[model samples]
Target chain A: MKKEKLNIKAALTLATTALLGCHNLAQAEPTEKDSWEFDAAFLFYSEVDRVSAGEAIFNAKKTFEDEDVLNLKLTIDALTGASANGAVAQPTVQTFTRPSGNGQYQVEPGETPLDDTFHDTRVQLNGQWTQPVSSNLTASSGVHISKEYDYLSLGLNGNLAVDFDRKNSTFLLGFSYFQDTFTPEGGIPNPLISMLIGDRNAPTWDDDFAKTRLGSEDDKTTADILLGFTQVINRRMLMQFNYSYSTVDGYLNDPFKIVSIVDINGVTQDNIYESRPDSRVKQSLYAQSMYHFDNVVLDVSYRYMWDDWEIESHTIDSRFRIPMGDSLGKESYLQPHFRFYQQSAADFYRPFLLEENALPTFVSADYRIGEMAAFTVGLKYGMLVNDGNELAFRLEYYHQTPTDAGFEEPGVLNDVELYPTIDAVIVQVTYSF
Target chain B: MKTKFKLTLLVPLIVSATGCASLGVEPWERDLLAKDEMSLNASPVDSALDDHIYFSKEASSGGKSFGGGGCGCN
Candidate 1:
């Protein structure tokens, strides 16, 4: 057998010791009595002098004797800080018009331009229902709605799981749909238009700003499908595999993002709003494995993804949990986590546009889709309280570094840092009773 | 390129065709697997929170969860 095949077979042997503890309604049985469970969490995420966010989430579930369960979730979050505007570094300070047209933001020499007015609050509400269809089959459906200051989204999803081989293996199929709307501040800018309008003393939409308006709002829709299985390979191991495909249509561009137009001398001439294809299709494969040893547990997962935009990515995540022994009391443990991610730049991705070249139909300067690699290191501590209650604290650090595209840098561009590294810290606390 | 992409999709089929009869334990021997720590989702809330953070920071998302929770952070 080939090495890949051998590895798959070996992993299969380590599959679903977790079948007995399955909790996703795929293996739930009718409850003998009505019962309720609740969980809540708080999270804080901070990017070095960039953005900071705080979120609160609550989830509750109700189990009924009729072989059905109802689950509800609520999430509220607020974010504040500066965000990149897709402009490249320059040898001298630069001043650019903000999205509202009536204001301006300045960037220091050799620094990426950022819009300092980025801030928003969002709320999401969700409901889910699951029912056992037969002795070995379960079905579930859910709906969710989210609202932000400038964006709104509504979605629905359904899933079905069936078991076979004396409950040792299960197959799952699911589908989801989402409809979203964008109502950006000061309306949406026309794609590829020079968004720079010089400094204006008046606080009103000037003629230059009016000429750049495309519309007041735009709409987007997405359809996604997933197929996968979970298998119990042995008493000590569990494994899962999944394949997903999705198609998205309509308004895929960021209204606030722009690309710098530069001359051969590497001097920025103007900043123009970016454009992107209206439709996209993507496919991905994922695998996960969990194993329990004499005293520790190991969990690992990997994902491979590709898209019509020519972007491809690979991600690996792993965690090892070790008990704290009698020193920390019962049910106390420390878990260490490591994650690595890498992605190729989109087909039309460019750090900046060249004034001597023709404009492409689709183009963007967003670094998120650019060639990059990111990694995370984290640790978590969990302790049992009052026998049935639990408390957990987790701290993590994330860093991402973008690479230069294979483009010729001219004049002053050679010395500038076209790709800046992004760094962030994450902290979370959770409780269950 | 398309053919190469299709190869990754064969992983599930290969896994499903492997030996199964002796893979798992009997129903009565599920004591260890039945523990709370062995649950498929040991911590649902933590998983969700991690997903949220990664989704907001990365360009690629979606494997174990649904799609279409759009945000305006861009």
Candidate 2:
């Protein structure tokens, strides 16, 4: 009787364990790979006759049985080719000193000035730790360091996520801070200082002027905070919204950028280093939705951003994923992506300064800060291989079109190409296991 | 200098987002939602690289995640 009772107890325990295990397995989707996982990708970006870049990124993650996770990432970027120097086109051949002040480059008549020495390699490293603070709360923190030929940046961030309403909703709060330093070649240019043109060769070059033109290195700091909410509207749809606020202070000028000092006829007279406000605040609101269908998934997002510089922007992006026939049963799909962006010019944006007008306290000629509309069209395909591993490739095209300066173009300047459209192509390949 | 934060502005936002748990189904009904691509950030690396490219080319950045690895590109 004793032996029979023991057998019965063992049988009941076995049945209970089997029942729970079977149900859990049926309800659980595979979200984590065994032990460790890696993701790596290579990107190629090229702009028509302007700039080109090659970049690679590698990411590794380890998951513990307890649900704690660790992640590390490395990024390497190699950039080469010419970049716009924020100078308007001229009817006559133009020559200007390079950022180094030790050299010069020439632009042909009716052509925009581009600095040909634009080149740099950057490397960044990042690490993050995530763990559950409670059944419904998770915390994550990370640190990143990046270095370039003439720049360095260090940053730290932390985030907290709380699940409510029986895990149907999640609220997240995050903050990050960064400190960056600049060590541009030949030192930082003094704001509003007139640049000496080919001083070593110019007949009227003055040594005294060079002494007052530059300063030592400079730095800047930025702080950002974000609040986010994510909710599952139904089994087939999910939505997320976020609000972000950021502040930046310290030296804000691009040491290499200069503004053209032009005369009444919009003819080049001299060049002066540009200046910008030492502080700025920016805010943005973002919303996204993802919906799944029987054979396809659709994702769409939008963002509205504004800043102290009086710059406002709007962005709309969408992606549609359609699965291929019998391609690992929905594991393989083709995705089409589209994005459109538009921005208003900043308060300090200037295509060129009028020699007769009094100088402003803050000014910049960078076209990036001017009114512009941009769009991107892309296609991506992904397939499953080696059982659960994945391989994907994408190709995209981007175009930027700038609006009229609205300032009257004087003399021959009206015939010059003031705002040239930028066209670029991007290709990428990624692998994950 | 404007648009300062106020609790009054958030009161309605929070109220509208909460008390909607009834919209969800039982735990067993989450099979479809559990798919890997269903996550908000299904592909982190893809997002990161795209952010870097746009940040360098555009005047406005950051409607997504943040942690500056900034460069003097402009």
Candidate 3:
């Protein structure tokens, strides 16, 4: 009887162990089912004297078997601003007389200031869709449409990505196409005028000059391609590199601006409309790396860029995020940042033009001339607002200086050095759930 | 401009691919990368505002992203 009782107890223990194992297996959570999620945001921004801009954004995403399957994004933006109109004192012709045998004309110059203002607005819409073909393959496509004043643009872009080595290595190919058209605010019928009076009795104005209005209609097309790589060196380090090239073709000039004409006697005459290169090619190489330590994060980046228009630039950016407090509490940090930037001038950049010299095929009096430098400092603070929420804020200031190449005339109009130094303040806020 | 665009696309692809190949992080290591602040553009609104200011005051353009409305200031 004792043996049988012991055998019965052993059998019961085995059965109980088996039953518990099955129960635990049955209680395990089922593999997560495929799911979809949606998110949306609205942003509004305004500049003191410029315009107010707003955007509405919507995003939808879905995942299957723990992998992203599809994503759709849309954005609509609107910008409205008052016309930037200002008046400048200019000389007006009163009359002209020729002196006997002097071969020179005497003229009267009257000063006048004209006042003008404008109203401008624009709207743009963009849509993007992405789909995963396999565990390691994905494709994305996008389209955009915009309208401003008399200008319109339509664009399309697409990209394909393939992953390798368990999603650590990825290869991507992309293409983009853009078509744009522009029409000036005023109808074309304006007349062109010369500074010097050649034939007083003949018609010196033509329709072509009138048709080339400020902000006139223009057509343009652009295409681009890119390649990139990213790597996680260690638990505390990461890095990435990228290369890109692009081409742009079409009317690429400011029709509103005029080139000054000077007489042999060093006197200014009427201004003539100017034109620029119709096409441009640009390329860039960029690399970035980050290192995270126990108490701080160090970031650095470099970019080399060049263009067929004789413009080249090198940019080096670095930042360090250091934790300052939280000795008594968790999740408290403060970071201060600094940035510096510099760039070379464009080929067509010129401070002033001489009357006796032959003008180049393309020329510009715009003052983004020579070399430039900028410095920025900022601070960020982060802390938990509550059990389920966090809050962060950032504030920054920036300043810049002109290069030695500077402007043609130090104190004169179009002189690069005379341009006022830039000063700006930026603030950001973020709340998360 | 065209070459710049191409370079932008090429660089991103090459970097992403190389990163994938060299990455050895376990699934749990992605906690930081999955954070919203890890994105290149932390605030789209602020970025857009900065771009607008730069476009109005400078000669260079097309750094933030693609597709923007036309402005007479240019």
Candidate 4:
């Protein structure tokens, strides 16, 4: 009898042990590879260059900026494969033109004033690997290589994430280092001489202005750090916040560009080549919130950004996805988006130059500076194609105008409209396997 | 300027308020939401492309994304 009782107790103990082991196995965390997914896409943009409302104001110049742009991408994810998990390859091609003739030359009678058009192509590759050390901690590292018409960049990034509880909150810390090489096509030249000649063949042009090579090569390094948090306030709302800081040092000039000077009589001409400031620091804070109420989703986000170059910007963005009731025997949805943005101009942003002025180290004639306000309205439609496929289309229009600060002289430099309204259309199709 | 500011604030508030009122749906009725079309960012690639174009042409950046290199476009 004693032996039988002992045997029964042992059997019960073994069964309990087996059950506990199974439970632990079931609750074990998934490997990094197991949670991975791969995605790739191709995108194209064809700008309608010839929309007319009247006698074209500026006889639109046909430059590289007028060409259609295309981008191709391939991303590979190893969910359960090996030490490496994520990789991406992206290539893009663009055609842009360099303006010729005096900056104000009119189209030669019926000559179709298009000048030089050059194709710029870029390719980039990135890869990342992740490892989990504990139930609540994970670490990841990544590397990237990018090459463009006049520049090459190599970068390394690392991140660590911690989950406080499996439930509703998480924290992420990350850092990135970037090293970039800028190599101009014809080498760097004296800014003033290059502008005065307007042609690359001038004998005064010097390739030595470039810090690195005969191609006018310059190198820059940047370091960035980021911290982010996501918290679920309740069952229906989620909020996230992120803060980032970045510092850049070394050569930071645009070698191919020249500064323009405007005389007292309002006549503009290209002058000495310009070099940009060698260092910049930027910081940003962002917050986003989403609420799920029944069938509707509401998303709102805000961002504040500041840079050491005396540029500060504020942005507010929001979107509402609404499912429309059956109006034409089909179910559809409409999503309207709105955004507001304002920024202080860069320290070196100038609409026109003073003849006898001391030139800054860096300057840009680009008009996006000067305070500006923009508004956007958009709509989207989705049509079910099959059980697992759908087609979606989106249309959005935006209009912007300069703000008070942008109009220093009210009627002088600001006479020409700085902001041009834009219209865009987006269409996509998706299939799930 | 005042008009623009009011318009900016009013439009979003009205939309959100109206949207909030009609937010709830039965679980089964959420079939539409379950469909990928209802996602706020259904097409990430297109969004990325649009963001790039706008970043290159306009004066703003950063909304609903992270971790892309900076350019001197602005």
Evaluated with lDDT, which candidate comes out highest? Answer: 2
Model 1 reaches what TM-score against the true structure?
A: 0.89
Error of 2 at A223 (Å): 0.4
Pairs of residues at least 3 apart in sequence or in different chains that clash in candidate 1: A15-A233, A15-A237, A15-A238, A15-A239, A16-A231, A16-A232, A16-A233, A16-A238
lDDT of 4 at A293: 69
Worst 10 residues of 3 chain A by lDDT: A95-104
Order of candidate numbers by TM-score, starting with the best: 1, 2, 3, 4
- Residue B40 C-alpha lDDT in model 4: 42
- Which window of 10 residues has the lowest lDDT sum in candidate 1 chain A? A11-20
TM-score of 2: 0.88
Residue A14's lDDT in candidate 3: 45
Q: Residue B11 deviation, candidate 4, in Å?
A: 38
Looking at candidate 3, what is the lDDT of residue A91?
Answer: 42
Clash pairs for candidate 2? none
Model 3, range A142-166, lDDT digits (tens) per residue?
Answer: 8777677666778888888887665
Reference-based lDDT, residue A50, model 4: 17
Of the two candidates 2 and 4, the one with more favorable TM-score, higher being better, is 2
lDDT digits (tens) for residues A402-427 of candidate 1: 88769778777887889889899999
- Which is the winner by TM-score between candidate 1 and candidate 3? 1
Docking class of 1: acceptable
From the highest DockQ down, the ranking of the candidates is 2, 1, 3, 4
Better of 3 and 4 by lDDT: 3
lDDT of each: 0.83, 0.83, 0.53, 0.51
